[model samples]
Target: MDPARASIDLATKIANAVSTVSAQPWEILTERNPDGGRTFEAADIARLQQIRSEYATLSMRGNVFCFREAFDYPGFSINEYCRDLHPNPVGESINLKIQAWSESHGIWIPGISEHCHDIAAFLHPEAGEDRFIAVAKCLSVDWYLNDSIGREWAPTMSPAGQANAMALREHIVEISRAMKVAPDAPLIDKACVEMLLEMQALSGHPTWFSRFLEMWIGHVQRSCGNINAENLGQVPDVFTYLQNSPHQSGLYYTLAHFEFSRDEYLDWSTLTEYCLASDVRNLCWLCALIGGLSNDLISFEKEFVTHQSQSNFVVVLMLNYPALTLGEVVEAIMMILRDLMEHFVTLSGALKNRCAGRHGTPAFRATGIFVQAVEWGIMTTWVWQTRSQRYQHARSIFRETQQG
Candidate 1:
C-alpha cells in the first residue's frame, strides 16, 4: 500500500473507533477515571481502555483521524442517564433552576436541566456529589447565560441595541472588579449574579472566576462586532472569522473556569504554569479550533437557514472552494477536523508527559489536570453539540444525511 493511502486507512479506523468510544462514558469502565463519581460496567471499561491506549499510540504517530463521513449523531439521553444514576435533591434543584432561568430569559436549551447531571458525571466522574452539583450548576449557568441569552437576546440590527450591549459589557467589567471584594455584587439578572456568586464560592480561586467573567465580556464585545457585520450584510472572511474564533467560542472563560474549579486548590505557581505557559495556551487554541470547526460543521444547516452561516467554516469553504458542493464542503471540513484533532491529541500527550515526569510537584499536577480538562472539554463539547437539540432545529440536507 502507498504510504499516504496507509495513513488514510489508519486514520479512518482511528476516527471510527473514536466516535464509538467517546459516546459511551469511560467512567463506566474505570472507577479511577477523572470524571466525577459515575459507575460503568466492568466489561466496558476494559474495552474502552484498550481503545484509549490504541488511540494514544496512533495519535502519537500522526495517523489518527477524529471524524469521518460515516459518522452517526449519537445524542445522549438525560432521562436514560438519570434513570441509571438517580441524582439527589441538589442536582434536581439545579436542573430546575437552569430550565427556569433559560425559559424566563427567552432562551431555548433542550435537555440542559436534565442533562446537567450527566454533564457533571461525564466531566467530573470522580468528584464527590457536592462538588459535582456545584460544577454542574456553574456549567448550566454559563451555557445558558453566555451562549443562549447572550446570542438570542442581544439586539443585532440597531445602533441602540449595540449601545445597550456595550453598556452590558461595562457591567461585566464592574462585576469582575467586584468579585474580589464582593462576589455577590449587583448585576443585571439576579439568577446569573447568584450563579456566578455560587461558582465563586465553590472555586478554589474566586479571582479566577472573576477573570472568566472578564473574558466572557471580551467575547461578548467581539460578538457584537460580528453581529454588526451581519447587520451590515457583510460576512466575515475566513481569516477574520479565525481571528475571532477563540473568543466567539467562549474558550477563555471555559478554560479559566476549569482551572479554578478543581477539588484541589492550585497555588500561585501552579496556576501560572497552567494558565500562562506557552504550550498550554497553544493547546487551548488548538482545542478552540477543533471546537469552532466542529460547531460549524454540526450547526451549519441551522445557521445557514437562519442566515447566520456567514461566519461558518463550512460556508467559508463553499465560498472559497466553489467547485465543491455543500456535501463536499462538509466532508472537507471533517477531514480538517481530523487533522486538527491529531494535532490536539499530540500536544495534549506531550503536555501530560512533561507534567507526569514531575511527580511530586504541585505545578506538575496542575499542568496535568489542565491537559486532562482540555481533553474533556474538546470531547464533551463535540458530544454535546452532536446531541444538542438547540443546534438541531433547522432542516437541511446535512441534517437529513446525518439522520440517515
Candidate 2:
C-alpha cells in the first residue's frame, strides 16, 4: 500500500500494455530522410568553424558544462532525419547574437545557444534561402523571448520586472498590428521587431500568423499569472501540473513553426481545417506531453542543483508523493513515457488510415507531413536534451539508475 510501490505497480501495468503495441511506428518515424544528403559550400563550412570558435571562446569565459558523451535511453535514439540540416552562416550569426543578448539580460542557460541553430535548421530544411533566413531570425528571437523572458523572468517578476514585461508585451502587440496592416512597413532596428517584419513577409497564411501571435500573447499572459500564483508554489496533482507544462514547454511554438512548412503544400482553408481536426489536435498535444516530460526527466538534476525545482515535473511528483524516492519517480516517468509513445503510435496509424482514401489530396499530404513533424518534434527534443550541455550533469544519475 505504500505510494512508491503503488506507483511501481502502475508503471508495470503501463509497461505490460506497451508490450502489446507494434513498434513499427517508432521505426518508421525515426527513419532517416532519404534526401538527407547535402553539399555545403566552402563558405558554409568556414562559417560553421567561425561559430564554433565563438562558442569555444564563450565557453572559456565561464564554467560551462561539457556536453555528455552519451545517454542510454532504450528505444529512443537520435532522429537523423535532420542530421544534415546544419545552420547556414546567417543562422549561425543570429545564434551568436541570441547568446549575447541572453547573457546581457541575465537569462542565459549555458547550452541554450546550441539550440538556435539546430532547431531552426531542423524545422526549415526545405525552405528557400530567403525564407530560411527569415525563419532563422524569427526562431532565434522567439527562443530568447519565450524561453528566457517569458519562462524564466515572468515567474519571478518583481514590480519593475512586471513593468518591463508589460512594455515588451505592448511592443509585441504593436509589431503584430504593423505586420498585419503594412507587411512592408519598416520597423525599428531591434532584433525582435525585425523578426516580426520577416514573419510578416513570409507568413503563408493569415490564420497561421494570427494564431502564432495569439499563442505568443497567451504565453506571456499565462507566465505573468504564475507570478501571482506564488510562482507555482504547489499543485494538487499531476493533471493540474500538466495543464500548464505543455505551454511552458514551448511545444506549441514548435507546432507553429511546422505550419510554415505546410504553407507551400496546402491551402489556408485546408490547413486550418486540418489543424482543427481531433486527431491532429491530439497529435499536437501528445507531442507536447512527450517533449515536456522528457525534458523534465533530463533536466531534473540541473534544476534541483540550481534551486529552480519549483515548477519541474519531477519536483511536482516528489511534492505530491512523499514516499517515492527519486529513482522510483524517474522509473515511473520512463514507464509513462513509453505508454505515451505507444498511444501516439496507435493514433498516428489511425490518422493515416483515415487519410488513405485521399492519397494524393492536399489533406492527405498534409497529414503525412504533420505526423512526420510530430515524430521529429518528439525525437529531436530527446536527442537535444541528451546531447545538450544544459543537462549534462544528469547523465551520471541516469546511468546509475539506468532508467533513461
Cα-based lDDT at residue 133, candidate 1? 55
Clashes of 2: 0
How would you encode candidate 1's per-residue C-alpha lDDT over 1-404 as one tens digit per residue? 45444435434643553344334332321111111111223433343334334434543444122333323223423233223332233444555655665566444366544533345444443455555555655555455544433443453335676566557555654554464334454333444555566766777764676556666665655543325233434444444555456666666666665575565543555645455355666676677767767777666545543434244565544443333344444555566566666667778888888878785787678778878777777666555555545454422333322332
TM-score of 2: 0.66
lDDT for 300 in candidate 1 is 52
What local distance difference test score does each model get? 0.52, 0.54
| Model 2: per-residue Cα lDDT over 142-256, one tens digit each | 5556554454445455667767766766666566555543454423225555666677668877577766665555444444223322343324345555555555666665677
- The per-candidate count of clashes, in order, stands at 11, 0
Off by over 4 Å in 2: 1-4, 9-116, 146-189, 223-236, 262-276, 353-357, 400-404
Q: What is residue 135's positional error in candidate 2, in angstroms?
A: 3.3
Could you tell me every candidate's TM-score relative to the true structure?
0.62, 0.66
Q: In terms of lDDT, which candidate is strongest? A: 2
Clashing pairs in 2: none
